[model samples]
Target: MLAVESRFTGASGLDAMGAAVADALVPQRLQTPDPHRFTASVTSVDLGSVQLVRASAPPMRSVRPVGSPARPDGAAFLLLGRGARGEIAGGGVSAPVDPDHLVLIPGDAAFEVTYPERVEVVFVALDAPGALRLGLAVSGPLRGLALPAAGRALLAPALDAVQAAAAAATPADVADLAEVVEGALGVAVRAAAEPVADPRAAVRAAALRLVDRHLRDPDLGPGWLAACLHLSPSTLHRAFRAGEETVAAMVRRRRVEAVARDLTGPAPGPGVSELAARYGFAGGSHLATAFRARYALSPAEYRARHGSAHHLRRS
Candidate 1:
């Protein structure tokens, strides 16, 4: 397998470039733009049993495969971002996608993508044999999946590395590029596989994950969650119930648990009131009430006991 990475800028003719690379790496032609300003740069192309291409486009344009093409001999996975929206039309089915989702398009299928704004996307092409070995499909119908929060956490760092490498990498660095691409794909696949365990469980898990992801957000709460997850307050409650839990209960429990964990550390954590506020507690008294009810200790007492236990263990 061989790899090629190319970058295009100021050139509105990206379809030609994509077509050329696709022909060499897989087998396809880039269709003409529908109606909009179009600019695309193919950052990296890795050609092996599988090929990977990282590309970005300027705002206001759409791109599509020429016709109802057969599934390519390879598979394509797209990691898209920056509020892009599009549709995949193939296999007698058409699917729409937005920034918050990832789309898997089969090489053999004919599809069109429309972007209202500048969009950045990573395109990974996997050969049939390679995908089979990896227990993946090289080509097929379009599948849209929401990236799990955990997946996003893992993807952020890997993407940073890819971007950095692109800035200063030689063509001979195929091995290094391949390694990074492989690692990123592995993480994405694992995340896709696990999903949320259960959609109901996902509410609590996602809420916890969100708190971890955005601990500094003072406005983080059920309302924020309802908007972010695209659920109404009532529906959100139902989802929590699906997990055999309540929204309020989960939030309080997580907040207190986080406080407890912090208290167990060597240094004193945040102030009780601050900590309470940080975790969405109404006031110091409210936090104290909950802490005592749950752990039979005030926040201060818990920290003192934890410190004493640590000292005893050290001795």
Candidate 2:
């Protein structure tokens, strides 16, 4: 089980408040004062809840904490709103952040955050295993970078989910919120890996990952995929090309392969239509067109030819 708490109060000394929040947020802590008058608070938790510390500081002129030790236990993702400008200095590179941008910092690295004006910022801390499972660096120092378009699309929803979860008071709601936070972390890590300019490729990659994660969904068509990847119809098609495949073809191929793999076992699998729809085929007939083209046999025939041998081995 994971735990989370939130704190909000006026600042006596902004530096002290910042330091307190930083200590509560990460093991390695630092803070600085800016010229603006602001109201700030730290919210969420680190235990599978997509820990976030957010602050809205006063405008014009900012200060940043410098030269903190690296945190080796977890990774961090930072989101800066449009009213803020800042840079992170670490790992032999200085990464800058614009409004609505995100930066990911791997665990086991040291860095500093700076702001030039009163800005709203959010920092998410993810556990080591969660970070690695999401294809982010497991260990080593990391610098910050901007969240690309595809990333922004994916993260914005997740962020909202986490924020809502953090505010939930009921135990059951908190548990459900934890799940949402975990999902948000997954989305964040995947988004961090996306290329900046070519959001189409990112969308395709994200869609493929989603399909791989939820292969059992019967209605996982291009429309569903497009919504999940935050792309339009034409945009999703372009992304498929960027990923070196057509969307419809890719869905058909993935469905067929999933069914084939399922058949290559001892257990009686779902029927042809069931398996076909599970992988997003429009219908049995549509599945047949592609399945026969790829395997030179209808779904039932192919299953009959290959299923027995594989089932026998398993048995």
How close is every model to the real structure, measured as TM-score?
0.47, 0.49
Top candidate when judged by TM-score against the true structure = 2
lDDT digits (tens) for residues 93-181 of candidate 1:
66555545556665555555655556666666664433432344433466666667766667656755665665566666765775676
Worst 10 residues of 1 by lDDT: 306-315
Could you tally the backbone clashes for each prediction? 5, 1
lDDT of 2 at 98: 58
Candidate 1 residue 268 Cα shift, in angstroms, is 93
Alpha-carbon RMSD, each predicted model: 19.3, 13.5
Write down the TM-score for model 2.
0.49
**C-alpha lDDT (0 to 100) for residue 141 of candidate 1:** 63
Best by lDDT: 1
Badly placed stretches (over 4 Å) of model 2 are: 1-11, 27-39, 45-49, 59-82, 191-315
Residues 51-122 of candidate 2: C-alpha lDDT, one tens digit per residue: 665555553233233455434343445544544676766667666765445666654456666666656666
Clashing pairs in 1: 70-108, 71-108, 72-107, 72-108, 75-138
Q: Judged by lDDT against the true structure, how good is candidate 2? A: 0.58
Worst 10 residues of 2 by lDDT: 59-68
The CA lDDT at 47 in model 1 is 38
Model 1 lDDT at residue 45: 52
